[model samples]
Target: MYPLIYGGDARILEEVLEGTHPGLSSLKCRFCQINSLNPNLVKGKIVLCIGHRGGSEAAWSAFLAGAVGTVIVDGLQLPRDFSRIYPCLHLALVQAMVKELPTTSAQQGTGDNRIAEYNIESGTSMACPHATGAAAYIKSFHPTWSPAAIKSALMTTATPMSARRIRKPNLHMVQAISILVQNLRLVTGDHSVCSKAMNGTVWDLNYPSFALSIPYKESIARTFKRSVTNVGLPVSTYKATVIGAPKGLKINVKPNILSFTSIGQKLSFVLKVEGRIVKDMVSASLVWDDGLYK
Candidate 1:
């Protein structure tokens, strides 16, 4: 909806609506939001650009948002035309984004990129959100949780990326995110897996696999909300549930029964997740079973 208001070329808008791109709209919205905001707010500010290779809209959004410049990197090899599109001589750096340390930047034609532009870009876009979500959980479960405490929880609970789909990992499909968050439990929080209390999916071990990240290491629990879309068959009905809910932790789904017609349909319902982090990790298998429509 907002995209229409931004008013790009008619041809670009047409391609966007076709839905051939994965995070194009996400990229578009991010760019729009940041661009709409004050440039001063983002100048010298850091932004996380994920999965789009270097050509990702993430970098564009950051640049327009007033970023001193972007640390353009990718999970894979950096692209050739990247420097051509985003010249480095203009800003601090023009390089691949990495989450790793000893952050470095490579320049083009003339080695004019600055040394002050040292920052890691090792896929922090993916890393930052999980941290943010974990902090949210700590705040929810322990209302008294301080910003510092929440930060501690997130950093302490951090885990490494397990594996990728072998096929094109760069593609951002709802199915890929679902499998990543739900199946691998790569992302922590209630939104990780919608449960019955949430009035959503009914737990089914065999159908949808469960993966979870426990909010606490030594002790304590937390709550969180996750977004889920119908990526499987576009049947008329859909539900959600947590496979093995931990102690003190509870899951609930809002607007449980999902009914829709046609393709590309989306429903955003909150998953009320609250509880203690009895362990370092909690896993739940969410099952989207058939209903009347099926």
Candidate 2:
């Protein structure tokens, strides 16, 4: 059977199959009864909620109800969103505005006729401000940190978020090249230094999130480069783990063990992924964990 679990990763499925994550079995409930949902039953599980607007309402409500994730069967997956990042994140404000906003004719209606929707709106307004504030906060503490470094701090230190579909079309876009590689040689591995940008793929950009958009049942390999700064205890060691990958996937992190000797020290790692697309969408995450910190 096709894996129908929305926002579910391989690790989550493995746990449920092994009877480890019993709370993950799908739960279908009425939207009107969201408040009545028993958290004890929903906790650690992924809830299925039918949504009419942007799925945030269901996602946010389920998040507050303690669900690990949510599946919103809606008319469309308009505006990509995942509850994993921040339970209340609103990347765009259009969804909330469209809900409560009245049409031109309705605005002039009698007071008794107009429907009133009182909502604690959540969207980009909240998220943008939070990011800006957080970035400013990080800047205040480390005046020497560059904007990119500050950005990395927020990303690498923040709690894990949800995943999205990665465009994995096999078609390669042919672009006009002004400069060619001196030797027409392929650059392999992180150590291979190339002055040209053609040697790298957009997917390998150093970002906190990962997404795979591969055709079904096709094998592929990709690599990403990420660096983390030592902000915690000195002389601490950290290791990387791949969590929530789909079946038949293999992830390797080179120099798996990160040992830091001083604060503000930065170390980089190359994460290689090997796997075939078993489904239309594949999602996973890499975690760097120390005994004292995640």
Candidate closest to the true structure, highest TM-score: 2
lDDT of 2 by residue, 131-211 (tens): 888999998998878776788788767866444422122223343233345433332213444455576666776665555
Most lDDT-accurate candidate: 2
- What are the lDDT scores of the predictions, listed in order? 0.43, 0.58
Writing each residue's lDDT as its tens digit, candidate 1 over 1-294 gives 111112121113434435654344433433332232234444555443333433333455555545544433445564422222333322223233333223333332133234324333323465566557767877888786545445544543344233341223444546643564454454343355444353443322111123344435444333234444343366567765445556766767676667656444666555555656655445543444555321
List the candidates' TM-scores in order. 0.25, 0.48
Candidate 2 regions exceeding 4 Å error are: 1-119, 164-199
Residue 106 of model 2, lDDT score: 19
